[model samples]
Target: MRPTFHLKTLVVAVAAFSVASIASAAGLDRSGQDITTFLQDGLYAEAVYTYIDADVTGNDNAYIGGDNNAYIQGNKTGDVAESYDFFRYGVKADINDTFSVGILYDEPFGAAASYSGDNNFVARGDLDATINAASDGALPNYAQAEGQFDALQQAVADGATLTPQQQAQFQALGSALAIAQAEQATKGEGTNVEVRSESITAILGMKLGENKNFQVYGGPVAQRVRADVKLRGIAYGPATGYTSHISPDQDYGWLAGMSYSKPEIALKAALTYRSEIDHKMQIAEIYPVAEALGINPVQSNTMEMSTPKSVNIDFQTGINPTTIATAKVRWVPWSDFEIVPPLYNEVSKGSYGPDGLALVGYDDDQWQVELGMAKRLTPALALSGTVGWDSGAGDPTTSLGPIDGYYSAGLGAKYNVTENWAVSAGGKYLWFGDAKGQLPTKKIVGDFQDNDGYILGVKLSYQAQQNFN
Candidate 1:
């Protein structure tokens, strides 16, 4: 049977495009004013989609016996993926040649689904034997064979002084029960974690210069960031309880920028930057049955994370009156990024101890480039195409989250319906790179493969000649 696209898939694609559009606009000079003016003056609205995929691999060594003595070997592996879509509409009115005001609404950020299933990492049947042996060897007060024999004797004695044959059967059952209990007390749950974030931003712009070549602007950037984290197939040890839910966090920030152009050379360039925003998240630490399910919620804590800063440069020059070429380069400093929550820190410092803390080391920095050309097919139509590349953040990636880089190609067109009205549409395809990360425990690793995405966008605008006395 042929596969059909779902409505959610379409929405995710559209949202992803919107994010790219916002990033594109945010990186533009003069607070993205030029693009806003171009759109608003034409009385238009825009819709966009953005998508991303990432893979992670890692190994973690389980330390049983209450953070000391006992040790058991285990492994884990998985992938993280997502898609986002956004739609926006706005209008611009010129107060004069030197100024204009506009308002826009768009979904700035959002995330879709993720997966981390258990395969080899879960030692189901033999887990009891392995954990029992490790705990008995490590714990100071543990008595190996003697403790097992004593428990067996007690069970036999309680069975109304069992017959010889029944006594043997009871003894064997007792030993198995003892071992199961020992194992249950020593095994540490392995980690198979995933997380995602989505948000939005809005702003206004102002222009200054005879030819509108220079401009400055700023506005409130409202954002909503949501994260879903899961740690599955865990083995519970004594002294530790686990929780499953981590609530989503939301906050707001602001943006500003400037631009310059030399019309004679048909050359233009601009610089834009966004400030970092913080989130204090409230998360559920542990559940009542966590020990049985191998899930633990760290103690109460605040999750502190922020989106990185970006810089973009755009250049356009006329090849002739009928054709123009444009290019863009963007820089995102992901290396400075960090996730520190009170609960995470406590778990690192307390429970699993130092080894647990090491998993927190992560730094990512990325870059992107784009090139495009627009040709005037006629007085009312213009056609354009662009290709871009986004570099992946860093090596030995983390399962904490995945936002790998990609290769993208896009096509676009602008149609002029009248001297003062115009409409534009564009679509892009992205090929994502694979990603992997190492688990703190031994023999465990996660892998994500074959990541790709797509985007579509539409924009409309109108221009009104201003009157001055």
Candidate 2:
């Protein structure tokens, strides 16, 4: 004998546990890029707020010069992971028994981190010290030729003629001196990075099958992205004193998915794919080393960036008349994503050949999975619990966010304010994996271990069903 599920009660079971998973998973994933609102059996709307705080601490590599054998753990890095928060809103309506429309908004991908204290990540010493450290004692050579270099520079300014050889020497000396001065000016500052983005998706769905049990949906997505980065101190060596600002840019992409549901046993499953968005954005960069490579140290230009494509699978089934089980799986090809600023790429051509390198990149894709259960304890109250894991982009990742992945457990509860309104709250604790931080040059620069963090979220939602038969 099969136990029949009351549609109203089953709706509560399916929606009760959604708050517990997908926050701070991996590779800049936030809000899980969820679309569950459109899968509900009735008109549904929700607003959610989530906050996350992480304690990421480790040791900076003392050997900033990049010799592996001579490398030693340096000073404590303090906590680099900053607290982050965001909001999400979703609304869905069934236009008819065979059609539906929905809109979803969320902050999908982002990062925030700051480094302080006596570490390689922070600049140290006075002007002279900074100059000497940055120039590898080459400051003395410049000091020796200060008189000649100055005379040649002033002569050029005054339209004086010189031999081509003299002109070459003069330019080389000036660029070296300028880079040292730039380094000295930034002395005593710490490293920091911040990235933010927002997305909105509009979707339309049409039902299929004899019982109208299956649905296919497609949508257009609008996304906005911006970021700022500053790399200071000896930890970055020649690349120290580098900064980039990516102005906000909006672009469009697409989303497609299919879902199946059976109200009798409260069974539902959805598989969704989101296409990558390409953004052409204004960028400003200040690279101290650029001058030394015969390129201007300051530049403002346009760069093209692609966020990354992803896929998600969400499933839920009834365990009993009052209990439901759920599972979520997500994949992102982070390895295919990277940021390469123009001036930085041009400067790198002197050493890495024509291919150059990206300012940020990952070596592997990310995979995340979470399993959970929800139980309706009363007609108006429900509780949920979940356990999750994420395969980080990779170990030896960029130092900006030096974490590999995480193991997490979460708890949530929902209370119905009325038959159609409800409030839910959830919290998750994460145990982060150990990682060795590296520079874009493939130099191991830091070691982070035994780190952890937490996430908290609250949501208010409304749902109303209509009889279509």
Candidate 3:
């Protein structure tokens, strides 16, 4: 007779490895958009917190001010990747043998990075010299202009009547001086970028087939997104001193999936697909150099954007009464994603043609895979390990997060606090792949090599299985 394996015996083993360890990836992927909580047996609820710290350093190309084609080694860029953290919450319950519902919330996409130190990414230059150069010697230096403006202001205060032509000249000088002063204050500042988004999904699942072995689920997803970006210093060449802010916007999308399960051996598999979400956002942009091209330097507009769609496959099966194996695969077409702020796109049109260029974009799609194993050592204790790999969007990617992909190893443990409550902790070490950082114009600006990072996460969960006869 064959040995009978009980699904309940390995519940702890599977839960131990359920904590996600992926906090960063290509094209702003975060939280992994996981929906596994809904697949758990019985009533399930979990809250997970994850933190990511990355050490990403490199050298800016030595062509900041000279020939753009030069690729000489330059100053060290320091650690530009900042530390980030977020939270995820999920709750699922069965209404009956044939119906179920779940609600999940997570930060689905984001990025944070800042550049500093004595690098080309940091702004540096004499205010007067920059003004003279940008104007091709047509505009007076800051000192000269300040002196004339001060004299005119004193004369006006002394009740001296001025001609309309003189008044116009004085107003122009004042505006020019103000712009120069503002730009001067930015000296020594570095480039920085931060993007954040949140998503909540409500799902309804229906059981099908004999013994209810197959299930299908669909849901409506609500997502909110916002971002801020700054490009300073010569590393950006003609694009320096550019800034943009995307106000928070909320949009809706949809998700659909199907799953199959064999309770006897604890076998389960799910394939999920998420639709793209479109957002109409209010964006404000400031291009310090726009005046040189005869266009207004400040602009505010309502722009349209769409986040990419994705697909994920999750699989797990019992290896024995005490162990379970798991595998996950994910795909995202990042190359289709782009952020083209109005002012930035308009400025680039002078060089990149009518369509212009995107302020942020990718060159390829992304694929991620992971395999893992979990074992229940005691009735209340379980341990798990996983190995993962990510195929980044492409090399010569954005300078903000200059990594191609990564290889990772993770370890996790879970302790049952009681029959209905448990806590899980996991950590993953990542070895990042080397990549060349490029601007939107396809100009290489930095080379990052041998970079690495780590992810840490904790999950608090509750589960209560219901038995039906």
Best by TM-score: 2
Per-residue lDDT tens digits for candidate 3, residues 1-469, read 5555688788887877767655547989987899999999899999998888989999988643324345768889999999999999999999999999999999999999999888877877556744443333556477877787788888899999878987876765665554455456578889999999999999999999979999999999999999999987666755677889999999999999999999888899999999999999999998876675678989999878899999999999988888899998999999999998999899878768999999899999999999999999999999999999999999989998899999999999999999989999999999998988888988888999999999889999999987664
State each candidate's clash count: 58, 0, 0
Query: Candidates' lDDT values, in order?
Result: 0.47, 0.85, 0.86
Ranking of all predicted structures according to TM-score, beginning with the best and ending with the worst: 2, 3, 1
> Where does candidate 1 stray beyond 4 Å?
1-45, 49-80, 88-91, 104-113, 116-204, 210-212, 234-250, 262-267, 287-301, 351-361, 400-404, 416-423, 439-444, 459-469
**What's the residue-level lDDT of 202 in candidate 1?**
50
RMSD of 2: 3.7
Per-residue lDDT of 62 in model 1: 51
Error of 1 at 460 (Å): 4.7
lDDT of 3 at 242: 84
Preferred candidate (lDDT higher): 2 or 3: 3
> Which portions of model 3 show Cα errors greater than 4 Å?
64-70, 126-185
For candidate 1, the TM-score is 0.64
lDDT of 2 by residue, 307-365 (tens): 99999999998888888999999999999999999888887776689978788899999
Pairs of colliding residues, candidate 2: none
lDDT-best of 1 and 2: 2
Say which candidate scores most in lDDT: 3
